[model samples]
Target: MMTDLVLIEQFDSRTAAEVARSILEANDIPVTFEADDAGEMIPHLAPVRLMVGSADEAEAREILSEAMKSTDEAGEEGVDGEPTA
Candidate 1:
């Protein structure tokens, strides 16, 4: 059986998209990446897209949101190698 997929997000690089794919997969959510990089010759014209089944859209977003929030909090704690007050 095939499922309908919905676009969840787009990343400028394949590495970023792969990271997101790993996260979703770890949580039991299936994901696929789409890109049109023209064989790595026109990276600027290609954006990696993260997609998940329509039925999993909301749960996927929630998981991604929490993960991104945690990442943001960690990055915000220090600025240019200096601790923030």
Candidate 2:
């Protein structure tokens, strides 16, 4: 595994970030998150940083974009019912 981690996305809530992480992992991409809450909180008050290997940055972004778009199409936004546009 490459140690060069790169921040690919920042989500307002832990649920959003976890969803993104699941999307990435489902595609066989390794990811890491940086947050103060240790993935226990459900608030959108703080941002969560989603990261992947530098070599996987482009792929990770594309996957996340598609995931978010699909969620938009499904009439859901940001995992907590917040508007995404």
Candidate 3:
């Protein structure tokens, strides 16, 4: 049986999208990456789309949200190559 895939996120870099895909997959959420960059000959030529089954969208988003939220928090705390006060 085939399931409907929904675009849940997009990233300018494939590496970021790969990280998102890894997170979703690790959570047991089905996901795929969509991009048209001449078969990755030029990955930055287009944004990478992170897709999940329509049924999995919410869970996938929540997982990603939590992950990104932590990243944002770290940045706010000055963890990106900077010392935190």
Candidate 4:
């Protein structure tokens, strides 16, 4: 049977996409990634899409949002008295 997958976010880098996938998976939410070019032939043309089932979309989004918020807060901290741009 086919599952209804919902697009959560798109990433320019595979590492970022995989990290999101890992976060969702750790929470018991199934996730998958789709990309046009697997070999990174054209960096600008490639986009890694993170997808989750429609049923888990809300929870997955919440988890990612929290993670992003934390990341943003961490970035806001000044490094050596200089704030990160």
The top-ranked prediction according to TM-score is: 1
Candidate 3 ranges with C-alpha deviation above 4 Å: 79-85
Residue range with the least summed lDDT across 10 consecutive positions in model 2: 37-46
- Provide the overall lDDT of each model, using Cα atoms, as 2-decimal numbers: 0.88, 0.84, 0.86, 0.87
What is the alpha-carbon RMSD of candidate 3 to the true structure? 2.7
User: Where does model 2 exceed 4 Å of error?
Assistant: 38-45, 76-85
Candidate 4's residue-wise lDDT over 1-85, tens digit each? 2199999999998888989999989999988888887477765577899999999999999999999998898788786757776
lDDT of 3 by residue, 25-61 (tens): 8998878888988888997888999898899888888
In model 3, the worst 10-residue window by lDDT is 76-85
How far out, in Å, is residue 23 in model 4? 0.9
Q: What tens-digit string does per-residue lDDT give for candidate 2 at 1-85?
A: 8699998988887778888999899999998988876445545546799999999999999988888788667785666778667
Superposition error at 11 for model 1 (Å): 0.5
- Between 1 and 2, whose lDDT is larger? 1
How big is the positional error of residue 1 in model 4, measured in Å on the Cα after superposition? 8.1
Worst window of 10 by summed lDDT in candidate 4: 37-46
Q: Pairs clashing in candidate 1? A: none
**By the lDDT metric, which is better: model 2 or model 3?**
3
